[model samples]
Target: MDAFAIQRQLTGIEPLNGSNYTTWRTSVDIMLGFLDYEFVLYEEKPAAITEESSEAVKLLYAKWTKANTIAIRLIRASIGETIRGDIPVFNTAKALQYYYLTQFMSTSYDGSGSVREHIYKICKLVNGLRE
Candidate 1:
């Protein structure tokens, strides 16, 4: 699909509230991967461009910067306004992702709960990690 179509799909993901972290994370991860912006989550930001920087280095820096910016914007856009203030500001997409994972990864299924439901939740968490 074209960039615009992919972007529209990304924006269609449900905005994350306090309860829907797993679903929101999985959707964002898939959309970002399709857009080739997932690298911003794994790759460290390149050094700032300087006047003396080589052409290749400058190009790399520019590419990384664009991806980083887009990824951050997409992530923030997926967040609900009510809880957005609770999340600290993060300049890098990777940092924002790390914060959310740590903040929401914890899950507990009491033995009294439906086995199928607990299993489903576990599967979702596993899928989120795989992304």
Candidate 2:
């Protein structure tokens, strides 16, 4: 996911960056909150891994990705439901395209062809706009 790359990049800080590790953690929490929960007030649960657990860092990244994926699904469901209610508004090709555009740029990636096409169209439009 592009967000995986972005989230990883955001937290990749050198110790000399004047921002502490805690700050990066908080940033991640904030982003996660925006993607899912309204606020992030919860007990910090220690990962229940055995001593034989391998690749702790990879596991942690997977967990983070999973959490974000759930959030994306919830958001998509909500948005799709909301948009579907506009059957009256969706009576025309322009309206359908407009709605698709709205849902498109905001959609989360799930490795679907439709999603890839949406990304490609958005990128094409964005490039055109930029030029």
Worst 10 residues of 1 by lDDT: 122-131
Off by over 4 Å in 2: 1-54, 80-131
Clashes of each: 0, 0
Relative to the true structure, candidate 2 has a C-alpha RMSD (angstroms) of: 17.3
- The regions of model 1 sitting more than 4 angstroms off are 97-131
**Per-residue lDDT of 26-123 in model 1, one digit per residue for the tens?**
89888888878888889898888899999999989988888888888888888888756666878887775465466456767668779986775565
Model 2: residue 87 alpha-carbon error in angstroms: 16
Q: Tell me the lDDT of model 2 at 117.
A: 65
Candidate with best lDDT: 1
Q: How close is candidate 1 to the true structure, as a TM-score?
A: 0.68
lDDT of 1 at 2: 94
C-alpha RMSD values across all candidates:
6.2, 17.3
lDDT of 2 at 28: 43
